[model samples]
Target: MTSGMAEDHRKPPMRDLLADAAFELFEEKGFEQTTVDDIVARAGVGRRSFFRYFPSKEDVVFPDHERCLDDMVAFLKTAADGTDLVEHACEATLLVARMYAERPERSLMRYRHIRDVPALRDHEHIVIRRYEHALAAFLREGFAFRPDGPLHAEIIAAAASAAHNHAVRTWLRNGATTDAVAAARTALASVRAAWGAPPTPAEPDDYVVVITRSRAPLQDVLHHVEHALARIAPADDAE
Candidate 1:
């Protein structure tokens, strides 16, 4: 009988070879012009080996996405119990951003290709949704006692994912500069700012004693007051 260890050794890193070959072919011939047989031929691997590595040619664009997502989930699971949920979700998203930044050129090429391809775009959307769902689950577990726990968790997850995507897309469109990670962090900061303060209670009994007048519109003034109150209020008190 053949030993399992021997068989594993004989596999010859087929997955990485196939993926590298597929990406090269896609870059050369365009995604629509590339075929599974062409990828296998370039890789010097069998068609069966190609299938064993990935279900289809399109999957080569994100060969390690599932693994990266699993890594994010594992990282999230290790976060402290009393950590801020939004901050934790942002940290999880940063893991994904770092994965892309690690291969900025390849990621930029894939991003450009995916944008023009309907199928790849759909696949990208599904992958992002999966990330969001994983983050939402983590947040829900972390903040179980919060009012509207699931909804709040989902909102934070969506915001974090959106921030990451926006940053990556911006980086790709701008020629994959070294500042991509910084841009991603900045985008995450915007999301954090959006959700940072808790909502303040509207005081119907209190008179709005405005001591000063500005050139700003009435709506702007009201908005500023609301934001100030939100900043001053305790989070749990607002809850």
Candidate 2:
């Protein structure tokens, strides 16, 4: 049997090898000029291996998004009770930022290629929308109590997505020199601040204390007080 260390000495995984080969070809020739055959030939793998990992050439440009989207969904699922849902959504976007930051050079190359290619640019938008939809689905459930829950969920999700893209694009444009994760945190923090749940007051300063005669039954008095508070709530909300 081959030892684990010995296995490590072999070529990179088929998926990665295909991606590396495809990117190299994309850089050497234009994205439109690079063929799957060229990529497989460069990687020394079969054409079947390319199809196994990526559906098409466009998919190769975004090899990591599917995994990142799954991770974003899972991360949102782990939110604790009372966690701010908008903030949670914002945090999920950082997962993508970190994915790109993990391999700055490769990310920068992908960014340039996408910018120059109209087809890839359109495909990238679809990929981005998938991430937004995942966030929106999670937020929609959390915000169900609100009357405008669906609308609020979509707006917050879009805001988070836009903030994340801005931070990442800025980082890539500036040569990826700055802290991408930190930039994402800062951008997403702004979204959280704008849309996160408002703090509930510990105690209302304005309250009417009702004193009932001792002769009255306790349960009846409690019910009356609750009814009075319900009546007052609408007026308080208006103010």
Best by lDDT: 2
Residue-by-residue lDDT tens digits, candidate 1, 1-239? 33324446555466667777888988899998999999999988678876766887778888878788999989888888556667778878888888888888788889888988999999889878989999989988877888888888888888888889999888888888867777888999977877654433485433344443777788988888876666555463668
Q: Each model's C-alpha lDDT?
A: 0.80, 0.89
Mind giving the per-residue lDDT tens digits that candidate 2 earns over 108-180? 9999999999999999999999999999999999999999999999999999999999999999999998899
In candidate 1, which residue ranges exceed 4 Å CA deviation?
1-13, 196-239
Pairs of residues at least 3 apart in sequence or in different chains that clash in candidate 2: none
lDDT of 1 at 33: 92
- Over 4 Å off, model 2: 1-10, 199-239
lDDT, residue 11, model 1: 59
Over all chains combined, what TM-score does candidate 1 have? Answer: 0.76
